[model samples]
Target: MLRRTLLCTGAAAITAVFTGSLWHGAAEVRPGPGRYGPLKVPDTNGLALPDGFTSRLIARTGHKVGGLTWHAAPDGGACFPDGEGWIYVSNCEVPLLGGASAVRFGKDGSIRDAYRILSGANLNCAGGATPWRTWLSCEEIARGRIFECDPYGERSARPRLAMGRFKHEAAACDPDREVVYLTEDEPDGCFYRFRPGDWGDLTEGTLEVMCGAGERVIWKPVPSPAALPRPTRHQVKEARHFDGGEGCYYADGVCYFTTKGDNRVWAYDAASATLGVAYDADSPLTGVDNITGAPTGDLYVAEDGGNMEINLIAPDRSVSPFLRLDGHGRSEITGPAFSPDGKRLYFSSQRGRSGKPTDGHTFEVTGPFRNLVPPQRA
Candidate 1:
């Protein structure tokens, strides 16, 4: 199941107004820094990084403990600082075919604890971390729902069904605004935003879908309770909801989102509620699973389908190869999160072994990341 790599070179002209006509700008680009270090993995079918980068086995399939078998599949997750140790909220795609179990990994890579967060959810894709430090585990199923998990690996977590259940993917929150942005994991997926009735109270919220012009799409507020029954053909037929949205990150009054089936990243303006395309890969960048914005305003995208690699898109809309996975070609990379100190980058690989019945692996890449560029004034 290995696919060819697709690379784009040269820079396309991009023009935008900075300070009226007083400062028109254009971006200069070149070929991306190609693959670094050894591109082939050894022994295990995983990835190998450069000298400073290292990969370890946080948890894998069939690892037994306390007479309970650890589940195989893993997906979207986030890392939180808990006391002296770090706590990771991992997602288990499903229980049926051994897709169960979320583990809390300590700093030493040992499982501090584990729990089955969601049992029946299929394709539990990438999720986001709430400002309160809880994990919003999303289910990428036909009628998927988002589940909130405690950092201690507790099974008491429940699905936030009020968030408009439909192929749930990544969820990002604007802590200051009490607003949450969500992405759908479907072809032509719609970008959704949820505003809690009260700050910190997620039980009730207003869910809306992004619609209208490409760069002027407004968050057409939708009725959450009415959207609960089941989505109709007309409801899911929008072009934006067609390929299904994936990763979502909100920062600096803007929301960054990705489409796995379309290989496109879009940004939504929180002030005006407008949506615009940020980056579009011709091919090879297909199947982008999750996207996260760095402090430098650049975006890091995890490639789930096709070639397994992590790509970075600069603020100037220049896309380039960042990291490449060794050996396994189908390791669905998701959940790209930067450490609080901005030193290390962490991501999850859902399917290290290609074919049906895939098991995921967790990896960490340490590197220096630049902050995102501030948005220009209108």
Candidate 2:
């Protein structure tokens, strides 16, 4: 599936207020320049951001913005461009009460109305945005599934049962082919693909598991998507298995995914039906989870545990730390998403050191990111 490359150009008009917002000191723990290079000491928050970067507090537990109170344990998030503004959809990783939330940010960086988008799920972990402008919130539980949501908080959060039932981790949509790639949360979970009959219409699709390695591959159609008698990998022989697969992002004819169990990042090239390791697990920066692509051809990987830092993978496969977390003990960085304009990078501290469910915070860092190539308005 070799698709056209999107070369974004121009820049968005940034407001002074967006660049001036900041949060107060979170903990006493001071962070130093990360392993890769020296980053400016954060003047306010606890996030160890790059030298030219600054962070703003989006919303924390108990905080109310638009009549709706903030939810606990913010996990995955995606930013959608709206009329002169953008909507940030966040996933709440609660037990049985897990769901997703949406917050609208004005062009001037002001927080507008916020509301609950999806409800009644379990462990709504990570998700992806569709070319049709919907958010696919994945539930990370056995027999769990994915629900497509409209960031406007208007559409029904209906589960597309054909996407398959498993411990889904995250999903990425290839706008070119209108296909969706999914990752599973189990150690031996199978990598999946959902091919919709009509482009951008997910109502009906074929569920398949990717098998084999390298350029030679196979797409094994799952016999039963709603209730698999066995794990997808066990059902299909010769299929490659991902250990604790977490997040995925599709770009440049490839789908890049992470495996926390093996601390590795894998790329599946749809054009050639091949699979390769973009970042080997042997690298010092392990516990790879979420992944996002920089317009300049580089890939950014968020840590699920080990170093608790965001790792940058160059096009040549070299690695560096983009940012690190110190005081947020054990909290892994999740949902590394860029604003439509590419200026604001949004991510969250899943368990923020307080060890309380109410401590997870969602923060937005603004800076001159390499991929800050402003996207064209839709």
Candidate 3:
């Protein structure tokens, strides 16, 4: 049942800035309609979707899908257009054996092929898609690095060490700014951006850490993106520290990211070099992890453990649960991305009902998402 009532909409009410310099403060943004309506009861697959939406299992860990054994602990993912069909790349968030895989779909939404895009990476967590159709697979380990993978499986994956050498979690490419924003999964991790020497070429780049507090922010070159002598975060004395940065996404001149430690969604306006808190712990959304936005201005944030659900943060800033995995209480929702046409969505349960990596399940939900209209203030 969708809530039709529209909440107040105006300037977000800033409440408090938790440490003055570290946090930009919390905001009470207005709530909007649950666009797709409330999630119905659990379906045949234990998924609660909207009225006209349905779910389908795409792949299960250790199971063969399109001739390839799906990897375990599926994490960050994205969809890329492939002619009349598309391809979905997902990360395997496992240590020692962590990697990433891709699944190709036909025009009829049928599985066409599945193959590996990246390998030999450890703790491959959340990552972002690039305009060039490459997937930035990030390794969430102490000495972890970023890998540029070809979603089409035409080229081999390569490590982009110049980006930085920390527990990298996610990357968001701001094509307009000619830089890629990244988030670290450390308790005191810092937000960063990598400026490649050549626009599409990420072979070499100058990694910089964010500094300052509040709306006005600045970037300072990271003494060593490789963290040779000192960790990148420690090298920048005045660099702002984020609480366990997780998923990241860039769109409409804003680079949006989530920090799981403090349960906040941050919006960095690249156009103005300003930063602000889009959502805080006070919102209905919690345990924020992987984030992705739609053409409709709706942002979908998956939960790591909060309710085993994917919540929608509407353009108006109102938050509500978009879908829920009914019986997978122990499991956390990972990747949440939409198809190129915006008619379908893809995501995964890192650890399914059994709470084991071997039981992970990647799913696809199809519905009338393309018709959603951003809620207006009442």
TM-scores, all candidates, are 0.79, 0.87, 0.91
Name the candidate, 2 or 3, with the larger TM-score value. 3
Quote the positional error of residue 237 for candidate 3 in Å: 0.6
Task: Give me the overall lDDT of model 3.
Answer: 0.85
- Candidate order, lDDT descending: 3, 2, 1
Candidate 2: clashing pairs of residues: 1-271
TM-score of 3: 0.91
Could you say which candidate leads in lDDT?
3
Mark the 10 consecutive residues where model 1 has the least summed lDDT.
1-10
Which residue segments of model 2 deviate by more than 4 Å? 1-37, 213-215, 281-284, 374-378
What are the Cα lDDT values of the candidates? 0.61, 0.76, 0.85
Q: Which candidate is the best by TM-score?
A: 3
Model 2 — which ten-residue stretch has the worst lDDT?
Answer: 15-24
Model 1: residues >4 Å from true position, as ranges? 1-30, 34-46, 64-69, 95-111, 118-120, 224-242, 367-378
Candidate 1 to truth, TM: 0.79
lDDT string for model 1 (181-285, tens) is 887765556777788888676888788776663444555666443445655213533424537677888777667777756566665656655554555655435
Better by TM-score, candidate 2 or 1: 2
TM-score ranking, high to low: 3, 2, 1
